[model samples]
Target: MTHVQDGGPAYWRVAIVEDHRLQRLRTEELVGRQPGLRVVRSCETLDELMAWMAGGSPQSLPHVVVLDLVVDRGRDADPAVVERLVRSGMRVLVLSAMASVPLVRAMIRAGVTGFVGKRDTEEDIVAALWAVLRRRQWITPELASVMAGDAQRPRLSDQEERALVLYASGLTLDAVAVALGVKRDTVKKYLERVKTKYADVGRPVRTKIDLNREAIRDGLMTASTVENDRR
Candidate 1:
């Protein structure tokens, strides 16, 4: 277990968090090939990773966690654990094929530093990580296309997005405030803005579920057109 002291030659301690076994292995292979990265863990879920962390396991709990959005059996990552990782000084890079525009917006609001699609080639994934390690935000071109799909897409503001994901993912406003590093009143204000935005569309956005369904139906994300972005 190599402890990467803060001032090294940009080498990274990385963990791959994907539910699929094959995908996890592939990610590990790609990370292994990259010059400055060490693949310390290849975990199948947040639970396993957390358990390893609890055991004081030194080979994992890396500086960078490459995450997949969907968990097995449709389980999602725990918002609390996500916050713990970020607060405990881990950088999270979402490496998912299931990223909708709303999801991407949500993650950004949650303070994720990087978002890369699983459809990307190994080289692209590596480059994305490099960008994040250098303290730059990186979103895969596919996700960029999702943003471009709706010229009038009234997506959530960063604050609103965080609030919405937390709300949609079953967190109370207070919990959202804690997770987002914001205040409860701030969460309320964002919710108010959310209501206003949806009201403009002749419907109200009362829950995260509503926003996600609408975002998909409106082609804001469903028509992501990843090929267009890569080309």
Candidate 2:
């Protein structure tokens, strides 16, 4: 773990994956100007970034990955790629135009540490990177309300709520089961019930990511809580 002392620089290696040439260059420039931050790699696609990572030494891996959710003429961002990046021990910050609740929830569940809208100011981008680097979660205030749609929030049974909190906290099925003092299969059953309950209220939780969003909305978990669980 590296730390800054005596007001000195704290270097953070960052990578960018954006398809648009102009946007990529602009983002690179913006990131370069930030204190204590460096743009280690800027590529047009996640594949290109992954290929570069494969050829480089582990020490060269970026501490943070700034990715676009939808890249023109390239593979769009997917949860699998986010999961892959998280599994590789890199903090991910999604900078995307798509700020829909579903998309934001999906990325969060996939383990991104922060999200910033494409329309956000350059300062917002820098702040997001700083938050993720500190193991915190950053979502703009507007998106935060979208994630917490209280008026349409669904109700959950005690068991279902417990299951959601445990699962969304990054616990495996077996581990959730152990915590709930139930069998692994029972944990799955509880999760299924929870899913149906959400769908009943017109809030579809079709995947693990959706369930994770619901957990956050239900006050069962926070983004920082999920990040901590992942760590």
Candidate 3:
């Protein structure tokens, strides 16, 4: 409960939001034992954490949340939930047993600062947590490889990727706009920006068909998605 007015807290506050009870306690214990970390909140679900976050005092919230994507009986936590927490001003460090590349990618899009596989050693987890607290991008080697796999592809913001995937998947501009809940012009801008990024990477997508092909190559969509469109 020590809060400095000018400088940050003396120690980092850590919250554990893991559905698995044993894992939750273990993580809580580990973080608590750390020299400069405190286990502020340990809960089974993000909803519980959000409920506790109701006080309107920033001090009530932890500095970083160690979250597991899977909850309840094998249910997956939506990336939107992660995004919400991140937007609330807490850094997120995913600590999940499910090392899914797509899930990691989605969480990254949702603004996760780092990730540590459940199978990773305690040292790795501690290191990842500290890195996140320092605003560093910490990712396991395996997860890093997954992200680096497409390093040659030009990066796009979340909006641009959504626009590319949906528009390239055969949706008209109007439909994409409706789906994204943006104006048609906004959607056009997103797609145009996506095209510019691709072009800057030397893989210009001049047409919608070219976009579809690029999307396929980026694994945003499958070839069958565009292939079936022709028929």
Best by lDDT: 3
lDDT of 3 at 159: 65
lDDT (Cα) of model 2: 0.79
| Model 1, global lDDT | 0.71
- Looking at model 1, the pairs that clash are none
Between candidates 1 and 3, the one scoring higher on lDDT is: 3
Candidate 2 versus the native: TM-score?
0.67
**lDDT, residue 113, model 2:** 59
lDDT of 1 by residue, 1-231 (tens): 344434654568888889998999988988887766898778888777778778765544587888887786646666447767777767888898854556555457557778888888877888888777765678776676766565455555555655664565556789878877789999889878877876776766676668656545543333232233234
Q: List the residue pairs that clash in candidate 2.
A: none
Which residues of candidate 1, in runs, are more than 4 Å off?
Answer: 1-10, 57-60, 99-101, 154-231
lDDT of each prediction vs. the true structure? 0.71, 0.79, 0.79
Candidate 3 per-residue lDDT, tens place, 116-148, comes to: 899999999999998888777787877666665
Query: What TM-score does candidate 1 reach?
Result: 0.62
Q: In model 2, which runs have C-alpha deviations exceeding 4 angstroms? A: 1-10, 154-231
lDDT of candidate 2 at residue 140, scale 0 to 100: 79
